[model samples]
Target: MARFVLVSDTTLSRNYRSVPLLDFLASAPTDALPNAIYSFLKGPPPPAAEGRAALAPYAVRKLEASLLKHYSKDEVVVAHEDHISEFIDEDTEVIGVSTMDPLGLGPLTMSYAVFFETRAHAYVQREFESLLARINKARSGKKAKLLVGGPGVWELTVRPEELDRNKIDFAFQGEADDIAGDLFRYVSDDSGEKTEFFRGYQTFNANFRKEWEPNPKFISRYQFSKQFPALEEIPDIVNPSVKGMVEVMRGCGIGCDFCEVTLRPLRYYSPERVRREIEVNVRSGQSNAWLHTDEVFAYQHGRHYVPNEEALLDLLRAVMSTPGITRTNPTHGRISIPAAYPDLMKKMSSIMGAGRNNWIGLQVGIETGSDRLASTHMPNKTLPLKVGPDGSWSDIVWRGTYVMNKHYWRPAFTVQVGQAGETPEDNWDTVALINRMSNSSLDNGLPFEFTVTPMQNVPLGLLKSRDFDSVKLDQSQLAVYYASYRHLAKMAARDATSASSDTNVAARYVTGALVGVGGWVMFQQVKSICRKGGLDLEKAARHGLSERPQVPSIAVIR
Candidate 1:
């Protein structure tokens, strides 16, 4: 009988590491391993879970599935890391290492210093190299041929050029469902058939499918508390709220130029299936559960859209009617209620307990105030305020504030600037828009926070066709961007300070106007610097600056 050992590169767990070893072992032929051992690096448990869960059962079940498909169940020996020290014997002909964790750098660190000091990318590289060295040394001079596989290996080894400089005999690089039969054949044969085995592995590099099957022996490492239970104890980890996570669907349909989720076909769960899952979790005493999906709002059940005004109200009513159920929230994707669909937004608010101290908060991506910039860069989402022919800035602000106060209490909005393909005019428009929004929030006493996150767009996929030289910022434009950021910070701080003072209405309004005027002056200064440096005027405007130098006679807009 051939002896095989499987080592997990990182701490063994379900969420982080995706090596389905249990399924593989269960399906493999019993003759593949008369004696076998499994080991894990065994790091501290997740910060929230407290590390009490044993990942061995889950790994074993995956291995068992593969073993049962070919070999008898009795042929495999399952041993944990602690058990391996007592059973290190000869005749171990094959050693398979699960390189999923090490390669992906699943939130674990080797040293306390490195964990705190090093960047994520550097730490991942270091851990991967270290794991590779360990595997090499362990197999040194042994007759056993070393094998590596896991999620990370699938990506790294799909192309032979991407492999480590050191030779790895065989790498199982895909969903290891049916791949185990092929692996068993390769390990059992004495005739060095490595080339033939790897050629079969190449199929994953071209095309693949993700298949899921229930493993009976699947065991969780932690025993969840009855009061504040962990997420894993409840079915899946898709859209999990306090109640449980229910998978609304798998994959996405939108082919956004920057997204990876759009690569697969969208598969949605039926409403019946959703209700059943919810009932199961709620019966188990979960009050708050999340509906997991890439886009929860876009969930289509059978032929109809879920939780749309009528359907969502019905789902909420059903969930509320359930015995002892209190709340339900989505644990995935930002919820956006289109400006044109204010009635729907109002309907959602009524159902999901929106308003003061409610669990639901609308997360809308208002990427930029500039409609033109948003349309050019992030075409997937560009919703602007609808204005009548004679509508003024005040009209827009008043309507926006009215919408926020009427529909929801906590409305989280995101704005993006400095995206690739953004011109100087686009940047100016963003700044002007932010200024208007901030003023409106202050005037109306709405609880809002403006998060300005600057991102440098990297050309990938469809973006490769764009001319980088034309869109790329010159030295002056770059300097203006930096200056604008500092000015925005200062303005925000001034507003905060003014809002804190307990002054008369007139005094408060005067202070706010002064702060606004100061901000406008700083904006003009940045614009002047850009002009002197020979930067594009339109680009400078988009950054929230004017071409004219700051003059004492010129009055700042109130």
Candidate 2:
């Protein structure tokens, strides 16, 4: 009945409500018993007393409105997750599904295989397959085309049969705004057949690489300025994750090698535009929100990643001064904004929460600690400083951490384990940095408190040569890997005992004990490695194994 039916995946549709004990275990039936026990010990789902989580997916919401403006009334219809059946009838011509990661890649991959080891997010994969089934249900010889796109669209291409079996005709990777009209036209034409990848990415030759690489074409600021969705455009919130998710800006001009943001050009909304969006959110009943940006601190940055402190302050004032904005958090950002301009950090933190709870969850990319590695891999990550000469990577990192701690900001630190062309010294140097942060204590406690994220390489960025599993780590790297888990495990323990509203005492207590013990065991092994002066793989390989009793083991968790 329509030109194209647009929908979001289950991961995006449902508000990210915390899973119940049984719900969490439903992901892995084989390990359900253990997962249940684990949930009971670590963190149990809140009793049904907590109501259903609800919110709209920002992408789908924006796209639905954008496409709505472009198309006539009967030509387009936006469907919610629950009402998916109504739109997938015989008359449906095209289905556009948006997802962050349809496959078990990125954070979800690490969650089950590495962190929990309990097959978490199995529901995500199943939901993806379920979406395919829904799309296929009305295909009584109708042959409606299926198109998928999003942050993790490339992950699906790795498994070619998924595209073929699912009848996925095209995947519009990166920003597809420019080609939306073309897609609609192609779908309308009965004779036209689409390729598996986007037109721009079709030329990417993945013949020689170990993985399928899709070259994404970024929309420059000159061509694509972001247009915020109008208030009335937002449909009812069926499932909600976080309130007030506004797009303050797009693209990180810094061009970090590992991130997808660098591939695009930098552009932002005016303060008035930002305020208008905030007022819309307040009217819609979302008091708190995490502003979506590749790099929030880098908003209004000039050609060389320079900070426009006054402009930033004005923008923050506009956001914070809005009638009902209780909390404002950044989706992701670089460290230089706070490190270079400490005053801004203090002012921003004060505006968000000056007197009461000042804790804010921020995503910061502190990929590696090795100076040479930082220089070679992500030179522009820290502004105005070339690695080794201007300031050592460690110093820059330490200073940033100190500044964050001083301002009472708790950041979620993303640290990569194994990267291409990294030496053993580079690995050890990273471990040493983590150790220093763990050991640092000021004013009777740790100046900086953060959850360490052990990031693995994905096919999305410059290092798309191999899958995450292909990464090999030496003993020192293993120590660092376990260290992150251990640190987080301890934090989980504290959360279990803490007086937070969502804290599950029984589950967190059990999880804390398990993680604490596991971390302690890892610590003991690491201590022995430290006694032996860490992993000297080259020296050990050069010397026969006949001399050393313990030949260090590498974990292959594929």
Candidate 3:
């Protein structure tokens, strides 16, 4: 019998491109496909490589090969999460859950999914708790330690009560890669010091390393050897994460104050390593990839983190030459990439044969427009540097947007509401920037697209002590929030998602309008309902969010 059962939440189990009806209706096209055909209407996303079938074999290999010396490959089982009860019985000594959001703190979970799914956060929480309950029920009171780790571990660590109630043994925050082997040993030999950033279940009383550096343990370990998973190892059962996922590098990777992984030093994998990972995915019948990086252009930097054109272009060329990577989707980039290397940006676009197609959508962080806020929360976020004649934030945003669009890359921005020390002037500035980008364009005929997430002061972020309840939204900030939802919905229709694989784009606009008018009132209901752990948003909306317009009425406007 296997000694451990490892599984991620529902998000990682599906195809990366697979944005289901609920998830799709809330945002731009699923994964924003550059190719016209597969963007949507392709049908349900094929299962992700992390699915029970696809990933179990990989876990076995990783465990037996080297990652785990305490157990054989045969001792590791990747059970279908929904059928967790069937596999997590007496024989299972440890249950390791990998989730992105256990308490529904993610912006996607809070800002977007809250409207249609109604009480969405609570629903997601129930689903997660139910899964945990399944393990407990199957274990039948036997001592199978429950280990939880992921980007969302903060949601639990922030509230120790949840960990105790759920009986979680260990919770590891930040990147879990470096400590995976050590974690395995903790289960196998039951010996090891408590990890630096990681805490035992009841250590809620223990303070973070320091106050200003809320999540200091999140920093990267320069000495840790980065492991590249064999394409065979991290399989997706439902659908692929569009091509495959390959981490090109990590460091100062965006440095967004609200991000779980921030303030990290820059590091890049050798081009040879990147190429091999891509080849592995190609061999596994998957082409293309969602390149994981803090900044694409920051690849192979020389000194002081300046863009190295040769290194950046060489990495792109290596990825392109990889037998089958047609579409290249990056996780996040600063508005400065196109600013610093306009010529190389166009060249890189051409190398990928994105001749004139600007549909290559990327997640860019433009958290706020106020220079003061930018300098305070995330000084390094602004691309091209604000010195000399480089242009102002507005200029960089507009110029970068124009440059990137010209090269066929559709960039979707991320704007936050509860930034540290945001003033009335800052809110107005944010709205003005949103308006400016809206007028400029989200795509050819589309307006700018951005998701406005309320800044929750989770334990791992710089503002960990900042309370979400205290971060109230003023009228100007509320206006920014409303506008962001409407524009993004419209961008979805124009984002080229098809009916073949996702919800009709027309419905997207309708839902957007409902949420567009819902404002913070709707968001509060989402939180309130979540605290109550209920899934019926309609009931919550009616009783708590009475001001929210009915979806049917919004449909008429559409």
Query: Using Cα atoms with residue i matched to residue i, what is each candidate's TM-score against the true structure?
Result: 0.48, 0.74, 0.72
What does the lDDT read for residue 553 in candidate 3?
Answer: 9
lDDT of 2 by residue, 82-189 (tens): 555566666677777887766556542543343333334455565677777876675546756777777767665555456767667666655545445455555445
Output the lDDT of residue 152, model 3.
66
Among the numbered candidates, top TM-score falls to 2
The order by descending TM-score is 2, 3, 1
Compared with the true structure, what per-residue lDDT tens digits does model 3 show for residues 125-232? 554676787777777677677877655676665564677787666665444343556556565444544443232321223322222223322222222333223333
The regions of model 1 sitting more than 4 angstroms off are 1-44, 47-245, 275-288, 301-307, 311-327, 331-336, 358-370, 376-420, 431-439, 442-444, 450-452, 460-558
For candidate 2, give the lDDT: 0.57
TM-score of decoy 1: 0.48
